[model samples]
Target: MVAQLETPILSSPCRVPYTVEGLLQVFTGSHRSFFTNVMAQALRIAGQGTPVLVVQFLKGGIGQGHEHPVRLGQNLDWIRCDLPRCIDTPQLDEAETKSLRDLWDYTKEVVKAGSYDLVVLDELSLAIKFGVISETEVLELLEQRPRHLDIILTGPEMPKAILDEADQITQIRRSHRP
Candidate 1:
């Protein structure tokens, strides 16, 4: 099931100041289930003129597998890393790896510039483990991120380094059992 935020997260008194420093939130577990839950949370935090960038790291592309681009308020920008959107093979080819690198570079630049109040690296942890990007590179970028920018990383098997730095770590278990 998709997890839903109880209410507008930013409007709460306990909300962290978006510009004070960078924060990392990691969400892990069932892909479809947790992705739904994380997006719900992002939507809640995106109000009040906060800019949000969503980088979809993995998605289906062909026949019966198209994913709707995620968007909330006008401040939200969504980019899908897998285009034509097919699933990756067990191993990525040279071209695929380069594409992933380019995406990572773009994400890094966006975070470094502090362009968005919130940046969601959807399925990024899985991408890192798949060798699409390096965990070291991600950690370095996180280290340099603008103090005020809040980031959300989602995907199963989150790396220990990311977990160490995350302000919140949520594991969304699947509700349905086979």
Candidate 2:
């Protein structure tokens, strides 16, 4: 039944909105479901024009290891930012801290280059929770983001400041099944 429903969405052409509000409207429900739909739409739109940079937030390999499911009519340059390989917990070793800094620097450089159409920062809330990435750094990135660039930051517990600045914000709550 699920496969049957997804077939049509997967087969349909990509049609993503230009505005952040429109994009938010497209994914108004649960995080997993919203992300799946958003990625599909982003991939479809990306195929039509320039490449996209997808920065996936890593949190125990949620949503299939940062790789977008390859469905028909999907096209986009997906770049996954898994963060420092080490230091799974909130407390990080010296090396892990350095690596985290390196990751942020690399991301800044990429955004400055203005090459990608979209950049998905996945599991950013975890970074904040663990003190891996500072809110200041995120704010700086948002302020410096290039025009026409689409940035998607996912995960639970998003900062109030970031949410305020976001053009679109979607909250995914847990659902209990019998």
Q: Best by lDDT, which number?
A: 1
Q: Highest TM-score: which candidate?
A: 1
- Residues 31-144, model 1: lDDT tens digits: 545777667766766655567888877653532211334555777877775445544454777755665676678888888998887888988887887888889998998899
How would you encode candidate 2's per-residue C-alpha lDDT over 24-128 as one tens digit per residue?
Answer: 111233354456756775666666654555554443232322334223334465543343352346876675565556656777787778766566666666677
Candidate 2 similarity to native, TM-score:
0.64
Residue-level error in angstroms, candidate 1, position 63: 14
Which runs in model 1 stand beyond 4 Å of their true positions?
Answer: 1-18, 30-32, 60-72, 175-178
**Which lDDT value does model 2 have at 66?**
32
What's model 1's overall lDDT?
Answer: 0.72
- Please, what's the RMSD in Å of model 1? 7.1
Model 2 ranges with Cα > 4 A deviation? 1-35, 59-75, 81-88, 175-178
The TM-scores of all predictions, comma-separated, are 0.76, 0.64
